[model samples]
Target chain A: MSTLRRNPLRALGGARQTPGFGDAGRVVPASGITSLLTGITSAVMAFLAVFALALSLSSGQLAQRWSATLSQSATLRISAPPSEIGAQTAAVLEILRTTPGITSTRVLDQDEQRALLEPWFGPDLPIESLALPRLIEIIESAGGFDAVGLRLRLASEAPGAVLDDHTRWRRPLVQAAASLRALAWFSVALIGVMMAAMITLAAGFSLAANAPVIRVLRLVGARDAFIARAFTRRFAIRALIGAALGTGLGMLAFAILPVAGESGFLTGLGFHGAGWLTPLAIPVLAALIAWAATRTAAMRVLRRES
Target chain B: MIRLANVAHDYGGRALLTGIDLHIAPGAFHFLTGPSGAGKSTLLKLCYGELRPVQGEIELFGQSLRGMSRDALADMRRRIGVIHQDCQFLDHLTLAENVALPFVATGRPVPQTDLRELLAWVGLAGQAESLPPTLSGGERQRAALARAVIMSPEVVLADEPTGNVDAEMSQRLLSLLVELNRMGTAVMIATHDLALIRNAKAQVSARVLRIQDRTLQSAGADL
Candidate 1:
């Protein structure tokens, strides 16, 4: 029992790579039709699991990016006739500089304004002749300015100026990103459960097929642990191999994805940095599931049938 | 080495054996003979730790069967070898591997020379690498006997070890059992063949016990 608990693979006659006297562990073949089915199933599930993990990690990164970029800044848009636009923009900039916690402010240059509108309007449009709103970008310190007091001062000084703090849009974007991360994790959990169920069925089939061998071992005074070890070790190794194949293929699939541009959600849809190590755990997790499933099946059958 | 007191065994409310008292000492030799459906196999099962007695206590090597854990019973069973009437063998294994199954079950390093010698003694040295399904009935019996004695068990219980062999092969197997008995290994053989019993009596000092009408009795005079 101590030996079994300490080194399960050794106890199963797998300690040595060669077969000899008392090497009955190979009596149950590690590769067979049932094992093939189990391997294919594990590979498919692990492939899905890798994608789910990548998606979850990517969504988490997306949330962090959105929170960092949107939380500390406010935009001031001044919509006035062509005559008063420059005056309104100058007044808003002055008010922003006087406000506490307003560290820096910048009014957009003609080219920067044109670049921002290039996505919506054609680049050939003449920015000098258009009656466009003058936009002021405001950057806040750790302590942001009081929005209500600043808005009152801006209303009195420049009635056409409107302050947009970006909170209304930030709230929904952060919520959507957080929800996507949760959904991705849920997908990963579902894949694990499905894989466990499939592997359990495979383990049960192997146990049933090896009933005669188990009987002979028992007749010769082999303990239940000895019989169970033979089965669990075989299945565990099979699952590990299958999961490794799946994880490798999945990672290769991720590598070929189209590069993410700066415009949309695809920019944060895959693994990065330390997140690459996350999928490696799939194979080990598969092996653990196989071990637990095979052990339970072997013990139950031996108790009921033997 | 094994004792059963007032042992009663039943199957689904049907009593097959009752009031059975047996004691197997070291180097003792006994033969059990009974009619068909007379519970000969059941009694043999009880002698080892395969089947627990229903009503009475069985002590194997000084430990009560009721008190021993399943693993502990398996430990005791390693010390007591068994040969079934069917001569069950793992068909996937070689004949040599089948003969060394006891050592395998006990997780011991099987000595190649000892395994070779035992197979040669059983007349199966030439067929060591042959699969079990390809062996003859007598060869299977010899292989099972070799496997049983490989552990040098204190007691051996055989359920019609010669059931599938010819008379000549039966005699040869009986001689092997007598030789084991001479080496201080207690043995009990359950068979309905009276001629084999007579042949065994001529070679060794043996006792014959018979089960009749659900009771165990000495059939020494009948033998």
Candidate 2:
């Protein structure tokens, strides 16, 4: 026993021997139903957790991308008469170029404007014939151009220029993405809680079914810790194996998903780079939860018997 | 050593044994005899810290049994071995493993040679690898006895240790208990077999206590 204690992993791996048993870990009879229930439950929970993790990470990436892309740029549209549109666009470009925080600016040509309106209208729409607004795209520096200051300057210089900073739509889009990320994470937490509950119930049933074992152990001068260790160790290993299988299947499913570039937001829901390593911790966490749940249940039942 | 002072126990909310006093000294040999449902097993349980007396102070190894923590009681129990009538065992474990349980429970390495010799002494060296379910009644009783003495406990409590065995096997088990007593381990056997008790007296000086009328009394020198 002292030799086994010196190398605890050996004990866990069933290397420790009893005189005639040849193995020290088979004190508790293996119950096929309990093992199956624990394994299936952990696998299912871990699989769902993987999806939730992917969704959360993807949503967060989407939110940050939207916020960064929209926050650094603004559009100035000169909606004057066709004759004055050129003059107003030129005036807005001059003001933006003179601005300290504005890095670069471009006026959307006829073809660009036509492409921008292609979704709304047909591809053959005559952009040069319509009395459309002239658009100026402004890219800001790291110290972004102040929206209020730029709007004032545009009003004085190009009265027909309406500076659309994209703030009105960007804020809501970022907020929606952030909320999605939060919801996904909450789902992951819910999965963990549900897994814990299921493992606890399983542990409880196992303890009930092995009441005779408990009685015999207690009668033989075995401490509660010894008995509880037997149970906790078994349940923890079961959960670990189950969660690993589930996580592997989930990752495989993710691998088969369409790439982010091919599809859209739904397809973008997966780990990127080092994020793939995140799900590996799920099995470990599941094992910890199982250990805790089984220990608590075992101690409770043993205490009642005492 | 176990000392019960004015111990009174109730079973199912009714008085079963009252004002029972017993002192199991080192190297002492005692036989507890009573009719069925006469509280002999209850007395043995109380002696081994399996049950708490409703009214009394029970002392084991000079420590009071009252208010003892479960772990402390378990530690105390390691010094006292008990053999139940049915010979409880982990059915999944082999006879040898069952015998070495005390060592395993205490986290001590099982003395392989000692375990083998002990089994051989109980005439079960050949059945070491057999599961408990495969053992006969006599084999189970002998296996239980081997388990009880595995730790070389200071006292041995046997609750009808020979209840299911033949006369030859019963004498065999009684002789084994006598041998353990000769080694200075206190022995208490709870049984209703007068012939076994008479047999035990010829081999060793033993005191006979009978539970009669819910009280313990020393038997007359009839045997």
- Which candidate's DockQ is highest? 2
Clashing pairs in 1: none
- Summing lDDT over every window of 10 consecutive residues in candidate 2 chain A, give the lowest-scoring window: A14-23
- The models' CA-based lDDT, in order, is 0.86, 0.89
Q: What is the TM-score of chain A alone in each candidate?
A: 0.69, 0.75
lDDT tens string, model 2, A1-306? 444454454456543344435344677889999999999999999999999999999999999888898889888888998778778777777788788998899988889998999999989998778888888888888788788988888888889989888999899999999999999999999998898899999999999999988888888888999989889999999999999999999999998886757655776688989989999999999999999999999999999985
**Backbone clashes in each candidate structure, one number apiece?**
0, 0
For candidate 1, give the lDDT of residue A41: 84
Give the CA lDDT, 0 to 100, for residue B181 in model 2.
94
lDDT of 1 at A99: 95
* Model 2 residue A26 distance off true place after TM-score fit, in angstroms: 0.7
lDDT of 1 by residue, A74-180 (tens): 99899999888878888888888889999999888889999999998889979988888888888998778799999999999999999999888988999999999
